[model samples]
Target: MNRLTAVTLGVADLEASAGFYSGIFDTPPNRDHDGVCFFPLPGCWISLFPLGHLAEDISPEVPKTRSGFSGVTLAHNVKTKDEVIAVLERARAAGAAIVKEAQDTFWGGFSGYFADPDGYHWEVVWGPMFDFTDDGALLFGKG
Candidate 1:
């Protein structure tokens, strides 16, 4: 049996994408070589590679051009509602498109959405009843 170990994103500029995620996640790349950068997250690896190269690696086919929303969103869960706003603010300053401003949600949490240069969506959220370990793993229902 195999486990999903990493999530790699194809970006136009590897260094810029690396910097963007590094700032938000507060973790520097563990390895950067030959136009690829790897950041080790709690239980997975986040990699940034050139779009053309990533396409070639996955298949001889060129990468697909995305339209509208892809229905995929990366999330950042913070300790406080204020942190959600702060994160969104930071992302905006870093050139992310603010798709949705932070606000109280019907789900009893607070969140907002933003998009990277390539239009990949991200949700920055804070839930009063959710907690995370130091290693970035979530522990829910026990605030």
Candidate 2:
């Protein structure tokens, strides 16, 4: 199978979500359609679609909750703890709610969490033990 290429969020307001994400990522949508907007990530991308439409697409999947954690999170791993703080700050300034403040972890990393306008949780982190490829992508390391 091909690599996972995108993480799509079901948003309530297209324009608002687009604006908030564009500011947080410091980039505009690479593509925009009648009800969807696309933001490019390093090896993947983020797609925003209306919550109703997204629900329709996944309607067959039983037990789709309307609110709360959604049992998923998207992570942004940076090279430094400072970068983690900077990202959380940027998210706060872009109208995100900082769910967790950046702090040192028992696992030997620094991280924090934020929720976008659409309530999707994002974790920004810096792990000393993490391995990354030359292109600035995360590598799982040798098996």
lDDT of 1 by residue, 15-73 (tens): 78878877767778865377888988766777888878888887887754445677778
Clashing pairs in 1: none
Per-residue CA lDDT of model 2 for 1-143, tens digit only, reads 78989998888888899999998888999664777899987788899988788888878663334677779999998888999999999999999999999999989889999999878999999987877777777865423
Worst 10 residues of 2 by lDDT: 60-69
* Best by the lDDT measure: 2
Candidate 2 residue 68 C-alpha distance from true site, Å: 1.6
Counted clashes in each candidate structure: 0, 0
